[model samples]
Target: MNTMTKRLTAVALATTLAVSLAGCSHWSKRDRNTAIGAGVGAVGGHVLTNGSGVGTLGGAAVGGIIGHQVSK
Candidate 1:
């Protein structure tokens, strides 16, 4: 059981890292807002929900808005 749990945890970590890195590489400055939003959302989500999903949504919204304003 312990071994299985460890394997699953490792897979989840790898997936998260891959996704973040892949996202950074694919988007350019033109889409900076989107990237920022996502990052903020992630942090917010954690903070807002005590590491729950709600914080993520809030962070995303705030980040996106900030990014947009910066671009303008």
Candidate 2:
């Protein structure tokens, strides 16, 4: 990827991480799991798809759903 794209992706990942952690003070275990799942899924998707945004998003969605259901 280009320098700009890498920078943007890093920024986005950092922002997502920050946002997810910042609001976790009151989150339930399931919420935390979902967040963790989404983060992992995003990274996995990015790796698997060579950083395709659609794959990353789709992975996050699927992971979040799985995480949410896992706690039930």
Alpha carbon lDDT at 40, candidate 1: 56
Write model 2 residue lDDT over 1-72, tens digit each, in one string.
Answer: 876776677568858887878878898989987887787677667756778999899888887888788888
Question: Which one is best on TM-score?
Answer: 2
Q: Candidate 1 lDDT, tens digit per residue, 3-68? A: 565456445644674577575765666476666556655564555465445655676677767776
lDDT of 2: 0.78
Model 2: worst 10 consecutive residues (lDDT sum): 2-11
Q: Over 4 Å off in model 2, which ranges?
A: 2-19
Model 2: which residue pairs collide? none
Q: What are the lDDT scores of the predictions, listed in order?
A: 0.60, 0.78
Q: lDDT score, residue 28, model 1?
A: 65
Off by over 4 Å in 1: 1-28
